[model samples]
Target: MLLHVSPARVGFFRAQLDTGRSGLVLCGPKSLQQARRLRNTEHFSGPLLVDPAVYEVRAASGEEPFPDVAEGTFGFEDPLAVSLAEQRAVGVTAPMTPTGYLHAEDSDALKAAVRRVAALDDPQVVFAAPVDVGWLREEDSVRQLIACLRLVRGPKALMLGGQRDPLAQHPRAVDHLRQIVTEVPGAALLRTDLAAFGALAAGAAFTAFGAGSRLRHIVAPGERAEKSKGFAQSPHVLFPELMDFFLGKTLADRFAGTAAPVCGCAACEGIRALDSFASNAGDRQARAAAHNVAVLMEWLRTLTALDSGPARQWWWYERCVAAVAQYPLLNAQLLQPNGFKVPAQLKRWALAAPAAVTVQPRADAKDYGRS
Candidate 1:
């Protein structure tokens, strides 16, 4: 399966070589240079997906889009910085939304960005990670964005992030997102975030991981080898410990699925469970990051190895039962065979506001917030 790594750079190539992976994910402004360097490096050969920056909503309460450099966004001056190198290396460019930049209201702006990006070079895949449940609920704008995306990048261009925790938000939000999934006419990357996997158990095109856990860890523990958050509360909810467990569970369950599993990466083959991941070599934070990476690789592998077969027959029955025992009503609908649906009230809430047109700059241009 394709193994999409993160942060395009010479170091990323080293990570690929170290792990013997064939797919890479390039993020931030340096993605282009990183992709090129990998092509030049004899140690590796693989395709690269570039996430220029992530765009997502700031809070769950309101419908607003903001630029979160902490979540990672390439700088304005270096928009095409990665383009020249990608051309030279004959590498692919897949612009992904940063951690918190994708808002439904930005559909028009997103389209414009896509158009500008597409003009630079014909990327292997044109993708966006729409994690904002707020935007997904806006049927008109979302459909419009989807149509435009399909037209620009064809059927496989758009990739939307799926439900993480169906129980975390109101029932209306869940329903709206599912409806958004049904209406969109492009490939999807169902990040099994917030126990939303059961909802996607039947026919998901792809899967991804939310940065909640990683983002949390960066702030909660200040564990960066050379980087630091400079002492600020992390907006991400996932705790490192929690991230380890969820990630491990997701992989082990999928590895032996009816649909032939795809991810081929170092972390997947190593760690077995979240607890095991937490103790698997290195410091506590290292193990946590490792676990997160492992699950992400597994997802990449699954997407790359998509095939015709029954979807993975999930067997987390016991864990699911326990979850139901605690969150019965919510879990019942989310895990129901028919899948969950967003309520009218939540739909109204999601559509309450529109996206603004102020292009703000990012903070970390050099390391995409790593530094």
Candidate 2:
């Protein structure tokens, strides 16, 4: 997975590079000023990307401006107006209106959007719409993606905005999503949010997530947003590689029981030994961000080095199995036996590792998919 860096988190990327960690960098900010600042200060020379702050655009359309719509955004175009959190500055796109997924029934609009973006100076333009995972289940999911792929002429990855898990967890969903991947074999796929990591096993080029762990999921989120922000922000811990998360825990809880010593990732080793907390939100968030990136980097390196689909599959499967074994909750929810069937390539690669591994079925298991 490529490390998608924002202007605010350039340090995370630089720190990883300075320490000899490997990852592909793609940089940009929703604002031209911030993007310019990142280019000038961070010396980030990678391809500039358009990070659509889709959250900035409210879904309910009306003639009046949204109350939360960032100020100063009155004339900004699609390429210019993308920031989600802050008030708009002069020339920024005003009150982005969240246009729901048009690709479902409006292929003409989707193509027009693609062609319009293809005309931009940036190497890649993220054509993201606030979409639910159910779009994959639509009859035309394959056709819709292929239509866009046909029109994209240059170096670019098509981003499907939405958390990938709800659709991805189901067997039919994988079949549908994988069809798009298979048909558009050369197209680069970008899945935003924490679930993006899961796409790697499904054949996406990269899985990108935002800075700070809390900003991880948005589309079809199973739960509500964190509602407990008070005068002081609590410290947090996350292990992206291990698929573990512990939010708003006290500093003392970090080292307690299985949580102590933190993650063993090289990135974590550097910060895990520190105070691990700060009264300031930025400091605490930055700490958690480092841990999250470190774990992801470790997994990225390991996955890339595997160098064979079957070998990669075998490795992924083994780690997932081990992870579920260690984190009991995962057994109930992730990489379930029913959701997996040994692909021909993976089965061939399975030979590289020991064959003692067997997927035994439970007596009460629902036949969620082929085992």
Return the TM-score for candidate 1, rounded to 2 decimals: 0.48
Please provide, for model 1 over 175-250, each residue's C-alpha lDDT reduced to its tens digit, 9 standing for 90 to 100. Answer: 4544444555444443234323322332334333333332211111122223323212211111121122333333
- The per-model lDDT (C-alpha) reads 0.37, 0.44
- The candidate that wins on TM-score is 2
Using Cα atoms with residue i matched to residue i, what is each candidate's TM-score against the true structure?
0.48, 0.61
Worst 10 residues of 2 by lDDT: 59-68
Model 1 bad stretches (over 4 Å)? 1-22, 54-90, 93-102, 110-131, 138-141, 155-167, 170-185, 190-207, 210-282, 292-310, 313-371
